[model samples]
Every structure is written in structure tokens, then in C-alpha cells.
Target chain A: MPQIFRRSANSYARLSLLGALLLAGGLIGLIMAIGSSSYVTRANEFIEQPIQFSHLHHVGDDGIDCRYCHTSVESSPFAGIPPTKTCMNCHSQIWATAPFLEPVRSSFRDDRPLRWIRVHDLPDFVYFNHSIHVKKGMGCETCHGRIDEMPLVLQQNSLQMQWCLECHRAPEQFVRPRSEVFTMGYRPAVPQSVLGPQLVKEYGIQSLTSCSTCHR
Target chain B: MRPNQNSQFRNSQLPRGLGRWSFGRWECAAILLCVLAAGCRQDMHDAPRYDPLEASPFFRDGRSARSLVTNTVARGGLREDDHLYQGKVDGQLTDTFPMPVTAELLARGRERFNVFCAPCHGRTGQGNGMVVQRGFRAPPSYHEQRLRNAPAGYFFDVMTNGFGAMSDYAAQVPVADRWAISAYIRALQLSQRATVDDVPVDRRPELDQAPEVRLPPGRPETPPAPEAR
Candidate 1:
């Protein structure tokens, strides 16, 4: 009991309590940061595909429309991946003998599908319909980013629940005219502030945030 | 050790009085937080269901989407309307359209054509499209007398079954859209050959002011009018 604790121990004890609280908060914050970061979310990451198809070449230079290959985007829940025949539609003649396109050719000749990697895969619980979004004036570029500039396509946005809620909460901030839904690099002729609300009203877009809106 | 077994062993080793003890509020809270953190596994993120085009381990082809068996027609897929599905009447290509041609249909056709056909056929059906410029075989110009004289069903048949170097677009273009594109092709044939006399009396004056420069096919100068929708 003879001076077992120094007088300075009081301040040390106080500092240790504060440090413990700070360490807990820092741990929680770090977990949250990791949860939303590109490492977990896979945003802005280019996935390797069966073929190194260039969106920049097809969309930007050749000016092929998105609907050309994603034929079911306007009518189905899933935007259809183009069958190998779609690739051979041009590659059969344009790059007929190019060794790089042998996979595309073999897939066509053998009638087997090319195992193209999916980029924007959402969690199994989420149900996204391309047609409804397209109908409601959601541009492909809005979520996919500048796909025409992507040599190899990448997931343009964090396909996280909170990220989806950003648009679902205020669709007016993002919607364009339905006609411009497929147009890449779309710029609002009127300022978005003026045009977004009008288009939202016109398209009858609801800010559906209920769990069932996506979960079901 | 398994968590339950470890806890059971610890409980057996505890003194009799301490064995009946409960955790403090902080200990309980910490345990609850640990349990909650542990619940963040990817079980829900990757539930046992195939997403569209997901690979399947069971199928030899590794496709979750199975191909339709030969001659297996889906419900409501009989497609008995030869005029619509095959572009035929009495086994001959018919010139008449199954649906009435409207301004709306033309607009839809123009949009779909640009998306599905304009790469090879060109925006004006001139056959010198971007793909042709890129060294794909140049298709016959729609303005050609041969194509102009061809029946509407002939164009639809060509799109449905394909001809010469071109492949069939039946998989990509729906039946209704093929007809619409056929109508639009007829319109293009007319456009290239039309003289001043073809312009309506009321619109003739507007034509004289300035020949409006056509933008690229997909980029319409104006959003479709409300009535168009």
C-alpha cells in the first residue's frame, strides 16, 4: 500500500478510458468503410471476360446502339447477353480470320455460348428489372457510366443497397426523357434541376424505398 | 473446440457459486455485438438460386439457362400467323402488311432499324453503313430499282431468314418489328426517289425554307412528342 499508485496514475486512467472509446468508434468506422469500399463492392473494377470485347470500339467508334446486343433490355427483367451469333453478325466478315476472335468463331461454329463474365451482379435478394427502369427514363449511362469510353467494360457504380437507395429516394435527380434513355453521354438540354422533376412527373416515377420494392 | 463444448467445459470447471452467475451489462453487450458481426456472412448475398445465365454444375454445358428441346413450343408461341411470323401468304411473300402503318409505327421502326439494321444497311438504307466502311460486305442499296420493286414481304423475309452474306435477324428483331422495319424500308425507298411533287401542299412551303440536316439515326433531334408515346 506504500505508494502503489502514483498521483499521475489518475490522468493515465482517464486517458485510457477515452482511448478505449475512441478505439471502439474507429473500429466501427473502419468496418463501415471496408463494407462500402471498392474492395468489397467491386465498383469501377474491370472483370476479365472470355473475349476482350471493346465497348469503346463498338459503341464509341462504330456507333452501335446498346439495344443492338442487349436486345431484351426494353422488354425483360434481365438485359439479355447477346448470343455468339450476335458477335458473328459482324466478326464473321469484318475480323473473319483474326486469331484473337477464334473463341467467338468456335462458339458460333460449335453452337456453344461464350461464357462472358457479368459485371454488375447484385445480391441475390435484390430484383432489378431493366425494362421498368428504361421505361421510367433511367439512362444506361446513369448507372453504367461512360460505357462508350470503356475499352473493357467495368462496373460503373457500387451495386450496394445504399447506392441504389440514393436514386430510389430521389429519382427526379437522375431521370432523363425516355427517348434519351439509351443515349450515351446524355446532357440535359434544360438544366437537370429544371428538367429532372418534370421528367419524373411525366414518367410517373415513385420514390419507392419500401423493402419489398427491391427485396421481392 | 466447438463453441458450445468449450462453454460447457468452462461451466463444469467453474466453482459452484460462480456457476449460477450472470454476465454484467457490458459483457452481454459485447457478446451481442460479436454475434451481430458474425451474422454478416454472404449467405443472403448468394442464396441458392441461379441468376440469369449463371453457370450450372449439373449441366454438361455449364449453362443455368437450358436450351429449348427440339420442336418444343412454349405456351402462346405457336406463331400460326404466317403473315406475321413468316412474312408469307399462301406460301408466297405478300406485299401487304399485317398491321396498319402509322406515324408511331414508323417512329418505332426507325428507332429499331437504327439499332438492329443501320450498322450494315446505313441510316438511309444506302448500304454504305459504318460497318461497310469498316470492311464488312456492303449490302445492296435499298434505293436500287431491284429493292424498290421488291414486295414488302421480301424485305421482311430477308430480315427474318437473311440473304447472301447477311445473317438472319429473327432472333434479335421481333416479328412486329420486322414488319415495321419493312415498312420503313419502303419509306426509305420512296424518300430517295421522291421529287418535289411528292411533298404535301401544306408542307411544300416548309421544305423550301431549309432542308433540315439529318442527325445520326439513333439521336433524334427532338424527344418524341407526348402523343407518340
Candidate 2:
């Protein structure tokens, strides 16, 4: 009778252990698969690009247009990646030298999008609309830093919430006309007393610049 | 599960009573394990049956509570201030547009009423909503004499600003919706009044129709015959 009871106890203990192990393994797998997308590559730091395309030689030295590569900087929220066709517009005839040509060739052959490393990533809470900033005469370099000058683009300023708040704190200081949005060195055209008072009265813009405007 | 009782059960063992018909050590261990397994229960009523606003941080304060100062939120409780814009923010209560008593508006008002008002004021506007059923004080009926005589503006003010235990619905209900609800309240008041002669233009929205109001028992609107003088 004692032997029967001990066998029952040991069997139940083994079953419980197996159940706990399965539960723990399932939980760990769920966390990992959810945390990292299997189909997409994610990187926190600089990723090796398909081509070591020199923004230094093209945009910096030659003073080429940024829109020449980035097709939708002005219109779209995403300053979209230049399609392989776009890269081929120049590189098709002149693929002479750009070491990382293998990744670009692979992208064209496999129909895979070039996974450009994001230098700047904003937190989920802060909603910084690119359209408004782009329309309000702020240039790409204002927030993104000297992207036109960097060879391998890296984040210049800490894109912290406080950093964005500092500008929103006083829009009168940085904001300019929509035409001058891409003008890197441009400042607000008019003084606060000269234009701010007039615009405030005309637009009937109430002070909605509260915490809920951004937080909620 | 707490181990205190299980430890006590284990300690209660006294050599299995040292005689016949006594339980063995394994039986004692089994009983102790069984005691530990039966001690975990959570309350189901934690979800609270009442309206969430009644339990909001602002109204539950025993003493005067200063709500966080924001442009949107009017500071003191509605009646606390001089019955105006609460004076903290730069706005007027009457700056809102007048709500037209259309059928569409009434339907919307009723939907809003159920979502918001039905918690405190019943679906029939009898002040016997679920909260009242759960032992809360019922809000006054819309057909009350004082409220019936009250202007649409007054109802809008009360709804937006709140009165007594009620908190401001300004945040919960929009300005246009507040006026629409006021118009609906007036309709309810008119329904209970029973006579068309006493109904104002704003209250007599459904005068051409029956099935509205339905007229209590025997009180029907009878026009007096014209006498030759």
C-alpha cells in the first residue's frame, strides 16, 4: 500500500514538472518571436549598406540635390528610400566603383527592399509630424542633422522629447515660411511683435499647446 | 498559498496518537498539502457597477480638491464658481451653437443619453437608473417642475457645468451634444405635461404626431367650440 502511494506521488510530481517546463518554454518562445520579426532584419546601430555611396562626394563636394536620391522628402511623411531603379538611373551606366554594389545587385535580382538603417528613431509617445515641420520651413538638417554632409549617415543630435519640446516651447524662434523649409540656415522672417501678434489675432489660434496636445 | 496552516497541521502530529485506529504519517502529510491548496480567491465585484465618473479623482475628495489646471478643464466644481465659465479659462458657456431639435439630433441625443445619462438617470428619465438601483441617490427627473420651467440654456449650463454630486460633462459631452441633450430633456418634459396649450414652441416638437408622449389615461387636448357672441 505504501509503494502504491509513493508511485502515485512521484508520477504526479513528474507530470507537474513537465507541465511547468512546457509552459516556461512556450512563454519564452512567444516573447522572442514577438520581440523580433523573423521576416525583417532590425538593427539598433549602423548597418552595412549595399553601396558605400559617398554623400560626401556627391551632396557635399558636388552640391547635388538631396531629392536626386531621396524621391519623396518634400511630399511624403517618409523621405522614401531611392528605389533600385533610382539608383540605376546613375549607377547603371556608372557602376564603376561603390564597393557595396553586391547588396544593391541582390536587391534588384531578388526584388527585396534595401534595409536602410534608421539613424533617428522617435519614441511612441512624441508625435512629431514631418509634414508640419517640412511645411513650416524647417529643413531636413534641422532635426536630422547634417545628413547631406555625412558619408555614412549617423544621428547627430539626441532626438529626445525634451529636445523637440525646446523648439515647440518657442515656435517663434525657429519657424519660417513653407518656401524656405529646405533652407538649412534660414530663421523666422518676422519678429514676434511684427508678425506674431497679427497672425495670432487673424487666425484666432487659441493656446492649445497643452500637455494633452502631445501626451494624450 | 500560505504555509502557516500547513505547518500547523504538520506540527499537530503527535506520533499518530500512539494507538490503534490512528492516521499514519503519509495521511497527515496529505491532509497538510490539501489544506494549503484551498486558499486563493479573488473578488469578482472589483469591476464596480456604477458610472466611472462617480468614482473619478475629482468628486471623491472629502474636502475641496483643486483639479489640475488646464485650459480645457474648468477648475472648481460647476456650482462652486459664479455659475459662469469657472473664471479660470478664457471662454464663455453660451458661445456654443444652438442645437436644432431635429429627429436625427434627438436619436443622437438618446444614444448619448444611454451611454452617459442612463447610469444615473434611467432610460425612461424617471431617475431610477442602475446606479440608483445599486443604492445611490437618484438624479432628479427631467419632468420636475423646476426643471421643466428651466430654459434650454439652463439645462445646457447644468449639463456642461454639473450641479451637486454630478461632475461637469463638458469633457465627456461636446458643446453641440450638450444642447441636443437639453432639447431631448425638454421633449421629455413636454411628454409629461399632457396638454399642448401649455407646451412652448421648443417643447412642442412632436405636437403633430401621436405615439410620442401617448397622453396619460384620459387627458387629451380638446379644442373649445366657437360660440356665436
**What 10-residue stretch in candidate 2 chain B is worst by lDDT?**
B45-54
Q: Write the per-residue lDDT of candidate 1 for residues A159-198, one digit (tens) a residue.
A: 8888899999999889998888888877676667889899
Docking class of 1: medium
Give the alpha-carbon lDDT of every model: 0.90, 0.56
Best by TM-score: 1
Q: How high is the lDDT of residue B13 in model 1? A: 94
DockQ of 2: 0.01
Name every residue pair that clashes in candidate 1.
Answer: none
Highest-DockQ candidate: 1
How does residue B9 of candidate 1 score in lDDT? 78
- Candidate 1 accuracy as TM-score: 0.88
Residue B91 lDDT, candidate 1, scale 0-100: 99
Q: Enumerate the chain B TM-scores of all models.
A: 0.77, 0.45
What TM-score against the true chain A does chain A of each candidate get?
0.97, 0.62
